[model samples]
Target: MTVLGIETTTDVCGVALNRNGVQLDSIVKNEKHIHAAQLVPMIENLLSRNQLKVFELDGIAVSIGPGSFTGLRIGLSVAKGLAYSSHLPLAAVSTLQSLAYPVWKTIPATESIILSVTEIQRDEFAYALFRAIDFIENHVPDFHLITKNEKETVEKIFENPLHHFLLCGFQAEKFYSMFCSENRNVSFAGKEFNACSATSIASLGERYLERNVIADVSSLEPVYGKNFIAKKSNLFSRITQ
Candidate 1:
């Protein structure tokens, strides 16, 4: 399966071309907040260099949010456009899952737990817990948008002393320090595993495509993980508009 994967759920803007689970080419730019402008060109450049066309791709897979609102929107806009135009299936991979994927690929298969968390704002994060038994990731119920102040509650979740668990993703270091202070049986995934990779997105997407887990392009939306609140204007402010 030939797939084009996009990872822009964070500050990174990444694109990858994967054929049958093998990554052919990828581009990543971590220049803070330029994903909106860089994503499309990155995709075009990668496809052009590989001598591939958008229409030739079997599917488009995107890391559908829990990160920057604008970044996710830009990536999804492009992916949905390409999928709609090419008549290709669209696959949605969770941002946390993409972050957890590299760790899973490198970890030894054992009955362990993986906690994936990506920074959302101030002290808050987008987090999910996965129980990896025999190399399969079983997601624990209810994704969370947690803050540092909620450490006590988070601590209770990782208080399990029997299972070997790893905390990973954007703020792994921060979580590592927090968990270690409590003497929890938790380890960090390391600096190299910080950013989400489009290549990983492609691989996961390929599996989704094979399983016919395609998304409805017209209705697909990034998982914001929270309700968006629009600011309301007072009478005077509305009158000015």
Candidate 2:
């Protein structure tokens, strides 16, 4: 299974090529606030380094975001174009879940619950709490791997206390604070794995693909989260009240 993965949810834009659930080559450029101009070329170079072409990929994975709105769009555009042109299956991975990789890796398989956080600026950040399931090897749709965003994200974390919970992402530092008081079972990632990367997305994407969980790219879209509905802070307005 040859899979190509892309991640551009924050200041980082990354591309990774994977063969049978293993990483072959990856390129990530830290443009911070400059994802638009840097993403394509980085991908081209990455593909070249790996000696591959767009059409050669069996499947393409994209980080469908809960990060920067424009950043997410740029990645989706690129992903859609590649999938359209090459006739490859589009696997839209969750940005919040990609951030959870470090949390998953640092801890063992025993840790079932994870509260992944990414800073979204203006006082709100992207968050997702995943309660890991039994490793059942099945192949379905990628989107199905993630339960849709329910209102009880925070509550879910508090309800089932696992061995430990991993929290890390672009805004992990800032976001971790929001749930610190509420969930006593939480554990955080240190500086090394703090940021988002395509490698992690690819790894998780590979896992999803193996499980037969996949989603059609045509119906795939970026998620900006419920926080972006209004311009100002939904969190701040509530806090001041």
Candidate 2 C-alpha RMSD relative to the actual structure? 9.5
Stretches of candidate 1 exceeding 4 Å from the true structure:
134-141, 229-241
Top model number, TM-score: 1
Computed on alpha carbons, the lDDT of every model, listed in order, comes to 0.77, 0.67
- lDDT tens digits, residue span 27-118, model 2: 88787766667777777778777777777778778888777887787787777777766777777788877776666665555646666666
The per-prediction tally of clashing pairs is 0, 14
Residue-level lDDT tens digits of model 1 in 55-132? 788999999878877777778878887887678999988888878888888876677777888887767788887766
